[model samples]
Target: MDITEFEDLIDRLGEDLSLWPEDRRSSAEELLGHSADARALLESAHALRNALATPPVRAPAGLADRIVAAAKRRADPAEPHAEGETAGN
Candidate 1:
């Protein structure tokens, strides 16, 4: 397997090379053994996999209300004044 073939495998199977089809796995591993570029590709895939594996951060408390308030202010600037309050304050 060459760099292009290795990249195609990564794109198809993602960071987990074990998930690659059996026929392609050995050649992909061989490419990884012989090429620095292939190793870099694998490292990048690992980083991306790690990032995606992480849980999503929670929004700060009351953030949804704040966003809705902001959207409402944009949608109808006069509405807040009609209620004698600033939209986001």
Candidate 2:
């Protein structure tokens, strides 16, 4: 199979060659044996699949509360300043 066909198969069947239909999997393997570009494409597809499968990183605990508190302090005109400080000081 050609590179375009191989790419289309990757898109449809994902990076797992074992999950592909028999004929397509054989064709993809044949192409991979002879073509560096096809191997690279398959590797890249695997990397992308792995990246997508990874769980997202979460914010630290109390981060939302800290952000909200900062916003409220900025928004409230009457919020207390440090001791001995005046407005616009």
Top-TM-score candidate index = 2
lDDT per residue as tens, model 2, 13-81: 899999999999999999999999999999999899899999999999999997886677667759975
TM-score of each: 0.70, 0.84
For model 1, which pairs clash? Answer: none
Indicate the worst ten consecutive residues by lDDT in candidate 2.
80-89
After superposition on all C-alphas, the RMSD of every candidate to the true structure, in Å, is 4.1, 3.3
Off by over 4 Å in 1: 67-89
Report lDDT per candidate: 0.84, 0.89
Please name the candidate that would achieve the greatest lDDT relative to the true structure.
2
- For all candidates, what are the clash counts? 0, 0
Per-residue lDDT value at 28 in model 1: 87
